[model samples]
Target: MNFILYSDVNDSSISASLGRPEYSYYFVLKAYHPVLESLGRVHVAASVADVDVLYRQLLAAGEDSVFLSFTPPQKTPVDLQCPTICVVAWEFDSIPDEEWDSDPRQDWTQMLARHGRVITLSSHTANAIRRAMGEAFPVLVLPTPLWESFAAIRQQQLPTPVNPGTTLAIKGCIFDSRTLGLSADALIPVPLTPEEEAVLAAELEAARPPALTLKRRFVIARHYLRLWLLDAGRQQIEPVPRVKFLSNWYWEGVRDLLPDAVHDWLERRLRAICAAQPLPVAEPVPLNLPDTSSVVETRVDGVIYVSVFNPRDGRKNWHQLITAFCWAFRETSDATLVLKLTQNDLALYYSELMTLLAQLTPFACRVVVMHGYLDDAQYARLYQAASFYVNASRCEGLCLPLMEFMCSGKPAIAPDHTAMQDYIDDSVAFVVKSSEEPAIWPQDSRLIYRTLRHRPDWGSLKSAYERSYRMATTQPLDYRRMSEAAIERMQHYCGFSEVQMRLSNFFEPLPKVTDVASATDNASC
Candidate 1:
């Protein structure tokens, strides 16, 4: 069976450097590798906005493909047709539902007409999907993200002397060799011998030298792993369960990049096991976060960073978001919040936002804003350099950039709600209750969309944020704790190995669902 994951590619963190935004798309794509290989070739489509046009292009090209779409389109275009399954990553898919509103997207009455078999990440979303589309519609829960490239990469990076495992070579790539902890002998020369090492060698040679030296650093560091494992073997006791968390550029970029849900479970599980004893501190394994050392993150005095998009008050909220900078001047005073309004930031949203900031807030005069459209390199650096990051929105799918702060070993303050609760633990960052503004933020729309999707009043996001912040900031915002909790949570929940068993079981019996051929009115029409 061919598998394809479709969603907005812009949702991913990798896209700024390589892939698009679709965070789940990347996670699922990465996770499905083994399963897809077991079944057949799996293809994923990032949230391509022009899906219909892209659909036609693919059809014209005659690519034998199957696709898995995430959410349904907002409007029912008569011409909208494609070979895809629309699955809504739901609340029970391991995310809290309280932060979302009951009528998240009730406005899109036309789109529900075209939906096929709607899949939820969990039963939470399944019920919501059914409620929204009527009893006639079908919803299946897909669950949390599957292990992606990181799992394989992990095997390479970790080699306990006792558990000096070997890679069963099936593919070759710089990342594979580095992450899998395989030696150069294993990367290429496709082991002609019956031994797995032979297969690994052939794969490495085929993978070629990485485009970047750092990419090959692990491959080069292979020699050290052998010695470390030797040292590990001499120790009597087994090492603590290695825990970790992964974060990246935009917080949303790496939300599920490391499979944090399962990681979180495993950490608590191991902690429970260790309740009678001491355990090793979980290690923070930050992947694909902003690499400030990279040449791209540099370009002069300041870089403009825009964290807000798709606000309920598109332009007006843009005005309030800019006001955040005014607070920054009094509170942070070191960094600037460049209001990035447009996708490309070409229209100078920062300048206009600054003009508005000047008119509002106590520290308006102290703040200065500029516009120059920050590229990935520049923005990544700014995100890195900032003393703290801020996300004062009403709603969120998962406030990812806060993860960026944690990943970079910096503290952040987010409105306590939505997916932000999933990863940003209280011990790792600052959390604040919801802002008392009249404006509806972008995530609020998603919140509204979610509320409409399921049990709307259930999740207490504002309270969760306040509590989480208290938890994270009880002590000084030490970089060590941030990194430690980040690593611990990431290791326990986000890592593929940590969650593979759960994911495999959940997806083992590929959801057996049929299309809803009919519907009834559940909304106030």
Candidate 2:
């Protein structure tokens, strides 16, 4: 049967979509397209908006086709006419009972159950879905595919040890200062003058919204009531008695019933609020580097530790990672910790990262912050120059960077929890201990977005860093063995042959069209 790959991310050019959903899906296309073509013609939608048209065309052609949506199940077009499959990556280990009523994606399981079959990236997600949906729900485990094309860019040579020491440059952006409650201004003030204090107080007062007028309160209540009613209908939840009558009217009709003056007033209030918010007037300075070195340079006998992630994403636990690394190597000048931040705006978090670094002063080890742009070749160099790939993430939804590094024969220092559990082990990585901790579900807005996930032990992570550093420095033979193991494990897990077999098996059970010629003729209509 033919396969129709559909994703909204595919709408943009690959280059513009890096560090986005498109980037991940691009790899999926590379891994699946060839194998799919061998079975039958594989067509991709122009965009997610075009999937409905494509689905209709496929049906008219009488072709045996399967629609695979590489986005969240809720985002899938409800009107599409095809046998659809949703590929999802959920990081949580379980769905709590309390979240069923508030989590935004709570309906995701039931929606997929009704609209299409499910494909998850790991068994953890599959189990969670099964528990929430049902034991008999059809959910397949399809690990994210690593593109073989990356093999061409893999480091051609192994890292050579330097005589005195080496600097490991971690390449990436820094988090915005505002994210860490630091001043976004170029200079953070220790104290404020009387005039400055008055200005600050006025600004703070302006930031607060004016007291709600009785008319405004009515308008806001009506707006939310209409939304709640609509949501209840869409998710099939029982409408509360208070809004039961509002649910009977079309949403547009209910909205029309509101006075035009209310909208105008609301708009004015929003604009006023926006105007009160402070804007940054100056660019932030670079943090934590020696005057002698303009860039991170590689040195011999020096172990370079590297990790790449978005500093703003709470799941990454970057603050803890930096703290642990500093504590572990405080007295060692032979090693450096490199953080490659993936966020686009470096100024957003540079000051905060520096602030965190400042708390670890009087240490011998150097911490480098890589910011701004780098071409693909430049990025590959960062990976190739590293002694080991480290991840202290609290959870993961199939870490692509970790996988890519392993594919290039680099040993890893990572936590064996969440998605990493699928492959991480002591044989291939310095596995840090972790335990469940309460957290806010990143996507949820209700109940203060409360949730739970693994929290990697900082002490254990510090020990891992020390162990990996010692191994890279003194135990060359063991390090080589671990590197080889990392390559072998990643090869088996993400190798093309293995992925092809899995894909083939996934489709074998589905019925196929018996007459391709007849189907083509019908499709022309």
Candidate 3:
């Protein structure tokens, strides 16, 4: 019954490890440790090296143990004496085919089938695993547990709101071009190699030429025609004119006149043309940012919005979020965006982020980047100063910062997709609309990299900003209601009690290991 918790991010420096994967494991461990303690002894291994040590110790002592890994299965050691459990936060529907050869999870699945079980954050992921592994495979759904520690922090009164139309006060480290090698005062484009320049030029040229063909034109016409017909039909059912007789008659005649073979030909032609279009190439953008210091203790008068994420990951969609925010609030001087980026080397993505921000020039709204080291208290203060939490991510395994913000009684502007679907709703958040878009599986980059992820509609996000601004400024009652609902939902979904119950249920069905030697022998055999 002894459990050894293995997490790679555990060994990371506090500030650096604040990234999603690290802090996610940190919070889960915080929630599960006490519960597991009541069951038996619990030990933590922050790195592979630590896990190796624990594995050896357990083997030598012949102790009944379970290895619980908070990282991907591939990252877990293949050889272990005890039954292993991998907790993963996969955001995609399935692993890519190309990744099958290079992905660590390929071996990890075999390990799981032989001597372990899998735990996922959502049913969406559970379904995906079932699709990949098999319906009969054992995969448990364990949502990321909320941090109960926040209760003490939440007891503190919220900071008073700054006066309208004045600088909103934010106390944190500001990341800029200086964090990397570039000078903050200058707008220098990141130098591109000749090869990179050539690739960029090719991509730009490809984008410029219209790829549409005659078949594509026909396909587009057919699609629009179907949509028009559907709309007209819906209108015809309405009280006033449920039947647009003349229009419907004319369309029906046209549809009858065109043979199905002609439509099929058009479809094939369109497909052929689409298939010929060049594949999108990943090209680096030129980096630029306005002069700013590493530390920011500034004030803003408008409604403050906040979003925290690691810029290194594309799923965060930080670039799109910044662009949408700028476009939404460009002419307004009364709003500010506070981005609390969690990464070890701010310089690694400083240029890219600044370059993205630089594109939103001559804007009235201010963008404040919070980076550098932050203690728990400082982090909590950053959350307290924000009026709303914003996330424009393409997907999430389990967004901890968004959960933490909700737990602190703050309303969010986020899309109700992926893990967020578990808690976000109209009652608690400004739900942005989204559609499935092509993406790469974050893990197993070498495997089927082409996958699909939710793409939030930029227009919807822009409107969310506008609506949230109005709610924060003119509709205090509604805003407070949403804040309260957010806290309530977090408590119900992420509470320690709920997590403990789920864990208890999950473990109850497993056979108890009475003899470590016997279990190890069986597993080895």
Model 2 lDDT tens row, 401-518: 8888787777889998888888899999999999998776554446454456898999999999999888888888888888888878887887777777777787777655444343
**Model 1 C-alpha lDDT per residue in residues 442-519, reported as the tens digit of each score:** 244553322321111212333432333333334333534554565455455444454445434434444322222211
Q: Is candidate 1 or candidate 3 better by TM-score?
A: 3
Cα lDDT listed for each candidate: 0.39, 0.67, 0.69
Question: What's model 3's lDDT at 445?
Answer: 38
Q: Rank order by TM-score, top first?
A: 3, 2, 1
Q: Order of all candidates by lDDT, from best down to worst?
A: 3, 2, 1
Off by over 4 Å in 2: 11-35, 95-106, 153-155, 159-301, 448-451, 512-525
What TM-score should be assigned to candidate 2? 0.70
- Against the true structure, candidate 3 reaches a TM-score of 0.71
* Model 1 global lDDT (CA atoms, 0 to 1): 0.39
Cα distance off (Å), candidate 3, residue 488: 0.8
Evaluated with lDDT, which candidate comes out highest? 3
Cα RMSD of all models vs. native, in order, equals 29.6, 13.1, 18.8
Name the 10 consecutive residues with the lowest summed lDDT in model 2.
516-525
Residue-level lDDT of model 3, residues 333-385, one tens digit each, is: 76888887777665588667766766567577768777655666667776677
Worst 10 residues of 3 by lDDT: 159-168
The list of candidate 3 runs beyond 4 A from truth reads: 11-27, 46-63, 96-108, 158-172, 175-296, 445-450, 521-525
